[model samples]
Target chain A: MENFTTKASAQPLKNADELIDSVETFIFDCDGVIWKGDKLIDGVPQTLDMLRSRGKRLVFVTNNSTKSRKQYGKKFETLGLDVSEEEIFASSFAAAAYLKSIDFPKDKKVYVVGEDGILKELELAGFQYLGGPDDGGKKIELKPGFLMEHDKDVGAVVVGFDRYLNYYKVQYGTLCIRENPGCLFIATNRDAVTHLTDAQEWAGGGSMVGAFIGSTQREPLVVGKPSTFMMDYLANKFGILKSQICMVGDRLDTDILFGQNGGCKTLLVLSGVTSLSMLQSPSNSIQPDFYTNKISDFLSLKAAAV
Target chain B: MENFTTKASAQPLKNADELIDSVETFIFDCDGVIWKGDKLIDGVPQTLDMLRSRGKRLVFVTNNSTKSRKQYGKKFETLGLDVSEEEIFASSFAAAAYLKSIDFPKDKKVYVVGEDGILKELELAGFQYLGGPDDGGKKIELKPGFLMEHDKDVGAVVVGFDRYLNYYKVQYGTLCIRENPGCLFIATNRDAVTHLTDAQEWAGGGSMVGAFIGSTQREPLVVGKPSTFMMDYLANKFGILKSQICMVGDRLDTDILFGQNGGCKTLLVLSGVTSLSMLQSPSNSIQPDFYTNKISDFLSLKAAAV
Candidate 1:
């Protein structure tokens, strides 16, 4: 194991051979490094295969909450990649796990503004569900569900991506928050937008969470990447040393910054957010240790002589 | 003009007639009293006609920025109420007017994330437009119009509502704000949600403006109903003494609180957000001088003999 001093000048490493000589575990970003918009990047499978052959453990971490680990595993398999559900870490899982770790009451209701992934995870962890419509053979009434019940009994309010978000949902959530000022408010991620079809699209959860903060004047505890909680959770789950880990990701703000803050070496992949031009002018805050054109470039590396 | 001292135990007037007798100018909340979800409230035409017969001047103000004065006037006419555009005051209009009065660069560019009404108002006042769809129509570009034209260019970043908001717009807007730390950041309003479709909806501009504050760690100069800037703008625009004018609204947090802070009489209507039961609570900060079910109830009164 090696410890790089914080004052070391951030210079581009010579090649993948020199870069992998000191690292043991590889942390990969899912969205752009492994795949771009549902399409796997070229040589990603070979890169992972080669890393495994050299005795390096791999972990797939993502800030996106729209998908579950099972779904991600299926998608990776469909794209011809060898991976398992246990190897993936998602913000949705992190959120549920965090709530479970806090000894959250199982009988207490939760008001969710998201999809099945978060709902299933929370329920599996023993929390009750509250909102949404149900199909009945008789007269249908829009029961406010956990919203009305927990508007008084709510122990926590979990927020995630909901494309069908409307005013009543926002008002109900905000009112519940105002009534119980001490109730926990958690957001899966804080990304304001996501790239789709080469254009940015509105992803509402982050913005809606931001609205809760404005009304309550209270900051939410984010449980995704770049947050120390997620990093610690990962370290404990995999029995990996932080110093021997290398975070390979596309975004400098989240992926690279997470590595920098968590005492791990970081490799910036140009396939996503941090471009070559952006890396050339390094601000004091954002600078990655090594630069690679894509995650596939690391396939040529061999493990350091032990 | 007349003034009354705040008596510690002054009881609320028993009826609408006594409530109107004690007040002169009537301020009205635009949303529920004058209109409800694009349809004017019942009996509003005759209500305003009767109030005007008794020499009462009216001001229609709203914290909602989805529509401007011109749009409001058209909506009023369609709903059978005769009103001029000059009688309406929106938070967006007040923000732009206030910035213009201070001699903020009329020619400098502004990045707007709101309705067409705000853009039209800013352009009419001689400010340059910088944000929106690009010529190729592939992406929304953030090219500030006057960044290099003058030393103090990019005069201000005005936030409103834009249903089409994305990451590039926020990223660029925040970048400009970071570079020009002295550049003005003005929020049209801070209402967390606006009533729509018989439910509360995201007050578009207000939410996005909140996100910028969270990211940049800066607060904007909010120019809306409860803010003093609205009071000052109204006083100067209408040439009336602040003490003589009354602030009428349906929401206690925005309307009654606005009057309390601006040295004017406050009236609360039960047709909107605040309920009488809610007001009885000891924790409430707003207390209204008059209470009525709606503006129509107030219009039924005859003036008290001098």
Candidate 2:
């Protein structure tokens, strides 16, 4: 594969009017795009208002599976953006939706390696939650209560970020996979590490999930951005062609590559993990169709044109 | 590939005296076959003496790379087996010897993700060892002393089991691989997990090594058993015809598969991980040409006086 170079001259949309004129759907990345460490970005509300006034559909897609759509909706509402739970698509939501589409047995128990958001989503989707072995007495209660045991009735494994992972969790999960060859294995995202202040932290789900995949010689169905599953889900939900959707985010790898891989146009903002230098580097694989200084840049352009 | 099943009703050996008559070489597994839980098996010394009396060449080949040949030789010597360092072939030794054969750079630094033994072996073979990032202060010494500070000078990365792996190790190793695309990536083994404590505890090199491989999208040149590299090294070292060698071991996946893949006759012993039930089961791929209850059982079998 050839490396994509970001050319300064190829910057599209001299004004926001041109950008607004071409875009049908507006997709936003949660972290570092709309909010940073719990603080909402400036002009987010006005930006949403402008897009809404122009008849553009807003979708919040995040690689973080730690929260549910309902939780993200509340976070968005708190940030003064008018949004419904359906407009928020967290990785957990994508995972639950994919599991539901597969028609996994409702009575079959799911041993989750994630936060309450993933468990709640799966439970709402009619799956019986079988907590991991480390869940202790709670796991004992769920184990024999189901028609089958962990490895037997575990029809699917839904993995997301879990800070409480240990050896027991890995063993039990591996056992379930080994016993049931046909059982579905799903991971919210495959990002290796997440940024932390003291040091880079293990992005939990991916490591253990990857271990299972390697051991069992199986590949997990990833549900978050850059995987076509989520993009396809969005297209069907919004009834918009992929080309009509515009994915706006700050990170090039997840956000830009997500749109590019999904056949949607991508807009990169200079406010996240990726920077201009990284884009200029030989290693970067992602390139956006459009570039902006910030979300407010596009908003001010739209306002000035109007 | 089809499942392997055991051949039934082979004539029993009359005695140990008749068994060693036709045998020319003796092959042994290191971990469970020779010793278990830090204790040598009974009759091991007697068996070794009897084989030596018959002038059979003895070779101990192991998939475990955590220990070097010197360590294995010392262990075997402690167990009362008259083995020298040259007669023992650990995976680390095979890996180092294989890399040496390829004329890998002697002065360049190799990022090692394995035990001290592997690092020592690589160093003795003329490679400079750069331990994992967790080595912290120890890494500072290696960094300034690195033979090639230039971007392209890092020759290769050698991966094995490193229990103390962290994000920085993975990131730097991945960056080096990205910076030097031509740099070789070698893995001692691809085994996902190795059982310990009678299958109660499981650990393997794949977890850390796999993370780097996954991030870089590069497959490692495996030098452990079941890989032709080890067998080819053995063939070149001993000047033995491939067809004349017989690989005797207990595990079907590693030992018998190694022989079958290396074009050598396979002899499976039931004294270790694999059982008769597994041989009769419908999932095994590599079948042994000869079967024995244990390595000593071969000493009890003899060619008929026809």
User: How well does each candidate superpose onto the true structure, as a TM-score?
Assistant: 0.63, 0.70
Task: Judge candidate 2 at residue A171 and give its lDDT.
Answer: 50
TM-score of 2: 0.70
Best by TM-score: 2
On the 0 to 100 scale, the lDDT of residue A154 in model 1 is 72
Q: Candidates' lDDT values, in order?
A: 0.67, 0.68
iRMS for model 2? 10.0
TM-score of the A-chain for all models: 0.85, 0.86
Model 1 C-alpha lDDT per residue in residues B162-262, reported as the tens digit of each score: 54444445555565565665777888877665654444333335566766674455788888867778777878877877777778777776777777677
Off by over 4 Å in 1: A1-9, A15-21, A132-153, A180-182, A196-204, A214-217, A282-284, A300-306, B1-60, B64-88, B92-188, B193-223, B226-232, B239-306
Q: Count the backbone clashes (under 3 Å) in each candidate.
A: 5, 1
Candidate 1: residue A194 Cα off by (Å): 1.6
| DockQ, every prediction | 0.12, 0.11
DockQ of 1: 0.12
**lDDT (Cα, tens digit) per residue for candidate 2, span A123-225:** 6787787763235222211231222235588877776665444334545666676676677778888765443221223333455455556555667788886
